[model samples]
Target: MNRMTKTALVVATLFSASSFAGYEVQLDESSKLTFGGYFKVDLRNVNGDQAYRDYWIGTSTYAPDTNQTSLQAKESRFNVKFTHGAVTGFLEYDFYGGGGNALVSNSYTPRMRHAYIAYKNWKVGQTWSTFMPLASIADALDFGGAHVGQVFIRQTQIRYTNGGLELALENPANATDANQSIPDAVARYTYKGDFGQVAVAVLARTFDNNGVAGNADGTQFAYSLSGKVFTFGKDDFRFTYNAGAAGRYISPGHNPGDKVNTDGSGDLLTTQAYTVAYRHFWSEDWRSSIYYGHADVEDFNGLNADSDRNHYAINLIKQLNKQLSVGVELGNYDADISATNSANSDYIQLSAKYVL
Candidate 1:
């Protein structure tokens, strides 16, 4: 074996031996520490439109049948977790090919997606918020296109989770004020039964000027509800669904294009999103899933725009062995814009992962 492999094996052996030795390591019957990770790389061929849009200008749209493209290292992630007594800690990072024209220029920065510590049922650090419960969907590959209700924000927060309920006092990273006046509050409740699990949550935060003068301050609230149905049979299957709504009311004078602003004007902008997915396991070694997602944004006149977006994806997973697996996904995005032609894009991805 290579030097690194040998060293790792030796360390693992020592750790296992130490656990069996007559030493009090404070082993908990209900909690334990574990390490896990996944790595993914994608080769993409862009067609029929751009992958994402630049709202600042109407131009810069990618056209149909672009050159052969490859998005390497699309979604590679590593995570570690520690749990002892009633305390728990976790850290997870992702290295992915970001979407946009600045792809090559954007250096791979280990995105700190989650880092948090919890005592008893209270948690503190940067992690997913309670408001995100309603926006999640089941997909074979998480690295593919926007998963409709998926929220990818990590912020500093103090949270409490008990039974199936959670509450948090969070400072969303999207907040722009230096004084941190806008505090985001979130709550979630989840219930699991023999058949499935159900979750609901709410997120509320104040909006400050994007560190600019004359921005009016306001509050934004989002609500989400989600559920999953698990079936056990010759072939295991799971169905997941989620729906969410978010609205913001901004006062005049503030930069409408702030990080937290969904609309250009300080006026109120409301959005609703929903997702549904189904996964069927043909055997212990093979599985596949298909999903659909939609999002609608209200316009300045309080009317839902015709410019909604829809996403569809299909994914397949294969377990190579006990510790390795492979996955592939196909995704498409469709958007409607006024005056300008509607946009659509399709992508394909493949990934291989090892678990420890």
Candidate 2:
């Protein structure tokens, strides 16, 4: 009796599985899709030496010895989103990739900004790094508004979030001789309240490269603190502090957590970065923000070109309509690198945008 009963159960399970495999699945009307992003054009007037911050992440920025003015729309962006049940996906692109070829003078090329999927508190694909907090980023007209203090990084990762805690394993870029196979690791804890949120994030990365400058394989540690505070109606404050092997988290190849030495050893460079900003709303359609950012990198060698810099900016924006806006920002930049050839610059930008 037992054997025959079991046999019948197994046959039923097999028949059910085979029958279901032939069926088709589709998203119902409840599922939704949308496209968005803004069309933006920026006009800039620049005065200063190199080390002046420009568009995007400020990497590979020109250090022209003279002042210049330019107009470009590289910040224009577009994105697509899909939502079905508990799963959501997003894809975003912007034209700021700087395809610096002799051709395409317009520099209008698409670059991936974000591409990821989220399901029930889990995220996968390329997005903001876990070692950085998005809540502290200021709403500035410039592409790299939070230049000095922001731990700006985006990479492929697997992440999980519960309440105020998040953890992720992210892709790491290594070009040295310490060949390794492990990914970068990061964790963060956020505390949210009625007024604002405070988050602390930490990162661990392996540095194994060409062994150049007597550098060897090793591990580096980094951390950041980011927070936001509500002041008045429609007014708020934002700040961020970062330290350690900031690596690409601060800016690609700018100042890493460690410097390779001639002794075939690694020296941990102590770098500190911070930014403070305050935003005020004059009316429902007008607002302004004042921000200051500074980064100081310990010079392990006399030739390091990324030792120190400071940034100051103020922006005034007017919302012309529900789908369009115009803004102007003034910025001052100062850099003292390698204790030599210091430079100072001032910049003003006018931006207009149409949203969709």
Q: With candidate 2 superimposed using the best TM-score fit, by how many Å does residue 148's alpha carbon deviate from the native?
A: 1.8
lDDT of 1 at 125: 92
Cα RMSD (angstroms) for every candidate in the order listed = 7.4, 10.2
Regions of candidate 2 where Cα sits further than 4 Å from its true position? 1-27, 51-53, 56-64, 100-107, 174-178, 208-213, 251-253, 256-258, 261-267, 300-306
Cα lDDT tens digits, model 1, 82-199, are: 7776778899888642533454564676777789998987889988656654324455554433444344344678988889989989874433434237567888898888767778
Clash counts for all predictions: 1, 7
Candidate 2 lDDT over residue span 300-341, tens digit each: 435454466677889999999887889999987766634555
Q: What's each prediction's TM-score?
A: 0.73, 0.83
lDDT of 2 at 87: 89
Q: Pick the candidate with the highest TM-score.
A: 2
Cand. 2 Cα-lDDT: 0.74
Which pairs of residues collide in candidate 2?
A: 50-63, 176-209, 176-210, 177-209, 177-210, 214-264, 245-257
- Candidate 1 TM-score over all chains jointly: 0.73
